[model samples]
Every structure is written in structure tokens, then in C-alpha cells.
Target: MDQQFGEQIGNNLEVYMDYLFIKSVEEDHMLRDTVDTFQQLWKIIMKLNLRKCSFRMEEGKFLWVIVIKDGFKANPEKVQAISLIPPPISLKEVQKLKARLVAINRGRDVAQNPNDTEESIWCFLCEAQLYGAAEARKQFLEVGGDPRPVMRQAYNMFKDGGDPEKLVDAFSKGRESEYFYASLYAGLYYESQNEADKAKVHIVASCNSPYGQRSDDYMASLAKVHCMCRNWEL
Candidate 1:
């Protein structure tokens, strides 16, 4: 983490702990207990003077550990000190840093399209958008480059006056992973047509199409539809 950002993290944690302590407790005893524990923890963190932190890859995911000055490991006991420490830098931040580093450190390819057949450039562009690469994302979408070809095809089929129900049918036969996004778009299309029932059906189907990146968020939004309407299950 950069020195500037670390300072911001330390400040936020201190404020968060304070906020938690001041919030109502009588109405929610559990809240009070949790706040108390965090207050104690924050005190310990303040004592430890934390410095650099690194994220290590474990089981295809990232885990962060703080490295204090002079080979000391920042632990829970160093609550107050840790509280003063900034939040652990996220992988998303790391990727942004990497992109910036590449832009500055590596030579640019002026060539229209370099020969990198091994890598799916479109997918890389998708990853860029997913990682908050706004400029690249704008360029990618501006060129009508849809990384998700399956969804694009389905949409084209719809634009060509294809049957909406059949569009849903076609996507239902897609890979389970594709079903959620496809259904999400399909749901929107149906909803616009005043087909609330069909829209609900497609939205619920997408939510059930194997939980993925935006799946939980989508499903949570549709929870009322699920509970109230008792719509399609799986």
C-alpha cells in the first residue's frame, strides 16, 4: 500500500470503531457486545506500529498479512496499532497498480493488433472492465466488441423480431454459467413489455442459474419477488 492510502485506511478504522461504540445498544444487546469487542481489539491495534502489507495467494484466492517494521508481524493483539494501520489493500487495487506500472514501465504496441493469439484480447478487455479499467472499457464497448458472444447472439436474435419466449428457451439451453446474465437481460426485456410475470420468471431463473459475480446481488434484489410471488423454483 502507498503511504498516502495507508493513512486513509488507519483513519477510517479508527472512526468506524468509534461509530460502532456510539450506536444504540439497549435495543440490540448483541450490537453492544460486538462493539465492545471491537473497541478492545482496536486498542491493541493502535499499539502496534504497522507498516507494509502483502497479499498472498491461497487456494485461488487472496489473503492479506501485515508486515510491521523490523520483521514484526502485525497480529490481533496489536489492535490499536492495527486500527491506526490502513485497510488491507485489495486485489482490485493491486491490479490497477499493475496496469499503471505496465503503462509506465513497458513499451507500448503501436501496432493495430499485435500477434498475441495465445491470449484472448477481448477477454482481457473484459477483465479490464471488471477491474475498473474505464478507458479500456469505453473503447472496447465503443467498437461493438462484446466479450460475451453468447449473450450478444441472443440479443441479436431478439432484435431481429425473434420470439421472446423462444429467446428465453434458447438461453435456457446455454451453459449454466451463461444463464444468469442471459436471463438478467432477458428479464429486463420482458419487463419492458409489461410482462411482469414473465419478467419475474426470467429474473428468478437467472438468480438460480448458478450463483456468480453479480448473482447474489441480483438474487437479493429479487428476494421480495421470490417471497411474495412464490415464483419458479430452480
Candidate 2:
């Protein structure tokens, strides 16, 4: 709908599914928007149910979210409903839990405020990681984040089904990166795919990362132990 009247709506509109919320600072602008929107809807042969509509209200509920001049806020009653959800027991239920988080995250648009905050975008990136690196990268970009580090790029490439050896080759053109955490991820992926030789090479490189040694991070040590247990040279 905004495609037809984007100039008119601007930031004064928010649409979700079939629901629409239109805001205007002046009474005449509100009336004009209402008339034009309704006329467009009818012209498109869509039906508007008057009984389900409210007008000229200072504040109202939209999809359980309360909207007012001060801006939108969550409906406590709906939040209480969510809190009553039972604990998940199985992997499928765990997946369900993640899906529920995605639903809860719909309360705000991460792309709307790229400069102010990114809690919502990071939350998305966390869940998207399960899907693969492409999904994760898209969420990262929505908040103006760059997915750059050599190892980070390599990990994302491998996770999205690119070959492990190809990653090392690609990043080695100008420079080489121990890629710490990212190399571990790529190594794990290679190991899972039965490419043990490729996994050992990357994991050993990860074992030598200066950042990991300085931080004394447990995962870095764990990677070393894993290589030892497998009898792979480090």
C-alpha cells in the first residue's frame, strides 16, 4: 500500500500483514490519508470492515502493541500471556523456543534505527546462525554491521557450503589470518563433513592465534586438546 502513496505516508505509517497504522500531525492530513487510503483500498476491490475499525483515537491497540503519541509500548497483558509458556523438552521444542524469540523480536524493526541501538539485530544474528552464514550476514548488515575479518569471512563462506581449502586460498591472496575463533568454526565444519585433513590444517592454524593465546580463552585451549586427542600435528 505504501508503494502507491509513499510520499504521503513517509515515516507516518507502519504496516504488518493486513493491519495498518497511519499517523499524521494535523487533523486535515489525517482525514486526507484516511480518505485516500480507503479510496485506494476500494479501488483495489478490498473490503474494509467498519466494525473492526476505530477512528480519531488518541491511543489504541495494534496486534497487542499499544500505540500512542509518545510512541509504541508492549501490552502487559500479552507479555503475561507469553510468560505462561511452558519449558521446552526436546530439540524440536528448543527450535520452537527459538522461533518464539523471532516472534517476540517482531516488536521493533532493527533496520529503522541503525545508529541508535542493535540489540534486536544481534538477537536476530544469534538465531540466524543456526540457519547458516548467509542468514547471519543479512541480519548483521541490517544494523549497519560489517562482516569483515578474514577468518570471519572464511567461516561464513565455509558455513554457507563453500569449501574449506578454498577459504584459505581466497584469503591468502593478499594476507593470511590465523582467524582464531573463525578457523575453529571452519575446522569443525570440515570435520563434520569427513574432511579430517582439511580440518586438522585449519585447527592447527587456529591453535597458533596470538589473540587466543593472550586472552587465555578456554575454546582456544579446547581446540588444542581436540587436535591432540585426534593425534593431529599442531
Q: Best lDDT goes to which candidate?
A: 2
Query: Top model by TM-score, which number?
Result: 2
What C-alpha RMSD separates each model from the true structure? 21.3, 8.8
Report how far off residue 113 is in candidate 2 (Å).
Answer: 7.0
State model 2's lDDT: 0.59
Q: Which ten-residue region of model 2 has the weakest summed lDDT?
A: 110-119
Error of 2 at 217 (Å): 22
Return the number of clashes found in candidate 1: 14
lDDT of 1 by residue, 1-234 (tens): 122122223222112111211122234454554455456557556432235321221111111223222222323433454345444398555545544433321211211122221122232333443443334333221112245655565444333334556656666677765666566656655544446787777777666556433454644455435434544554
**C-alpha RMSD (angstroms) for model 1:** 21.3
lDDT of each: 0.41, 0.59
lDDT agreement of model 1 with the native: 0.41
